[model samples]
Target: MREVRNKWVFKKVKVDVFRVVRRVEELMRELNDDMSVAGEQEVCSEGGGRWLRPEVGWVKLNVDAGVKEGWGLGIGAVCRDSEGAMLWGMTEHRCATLEPSMAEAEAILVYMNKARRRGCSRIVVESDCKVLIDALQLKTKGRSDFYLLLDDIYSICNDFEIVL
Candidate 1:
């Protein structure tokens, strides 16, 4: 029969290997959890909030009017990391002629155009302006002065991703 000490040493070696394997397994499980979370990108806005989940990775923008009615349009956009924390936030008032609908559209156009310039290829545009959203979605024709400005805003969609 094999010496008792030899048998005890062999058992110890097997136990050590098993412990190492278990540790590796635990580490791998944690790594998987982190990776899945890191893969997501979230964007929250006034209308609602959006998340990339997995397949979708995009910048999201939200626009709203400012306190001053005739001062111009106030636009707010925030870019977020995978964890729903804002990476960047911007709010601006444009120096354009003011009509509520046109101002809203212009704000969105500025936000989208800025995102495009920053090399954002995928984006989700959000606005509280239902009329503008409807107009863009409907692809309406003809023009009033307001419509002409809206048309210019619509034209901006061609340059980048706009989620209305």
Candidate 2:
């Protein structure tokens, strides 16, 4: 019985690892593509406190993640130019139960991937989740389980100028 259980766990782990590898490959391909996706990438100049614009030639991407008990996670990103005008925006819903920090980090990775896919030149990313920011900035060790996401974020950052 114990052996059977171990085999089942191993199978699950293998499948999860495969999915992650496939995802990383997909992101790499997206980054290499030069064509930008057509649509709204920015927003108006109104924002609450804590919103700041990046320098000229650099766009600021603000991302947030929210999770509702029993409901799943929602993540979004908005890009603003030096004039505080939005250039584009995106939102995503993920169905998974992970730690808040992990969820936030995942959301950030999602948006970073999007920006890379769009062939952004330079970007400053803003996030309210300190844990994710700290991890991205290498200020904290972060949870080991989600280190893959951090690694992916770092790799994505290499494709262009990124400020966290």
lDDT of each: 0.60, 0.70
In order of appearance, the predictions have TM-scores of 0.59, 0.67
lDDT string for model 1 (1-164, tens) is 12332453455333354765577467545534654666544333223544342124665565555434444445667554334434455777565557677667767777677777778766666666888888878877666876786777778778765566
Question: Candidate 1: where is the Cα deviation over 4 Å?
Answer: 1-55, 67-72, 81-83, 94-97
Q: For residue 152, what is the lDDT in candidate 1?
A: 78
Q: What are the per-residue Cα lDDT tens digits for candidate 2 across 46-118?
A: 2324344477799888888777667688788877676655577777777878788878888778887888788
Best by TM-score: 2
> TM-score of model 1 relative to the true fold?
0.59
Clashing pairs in 1: 125-163
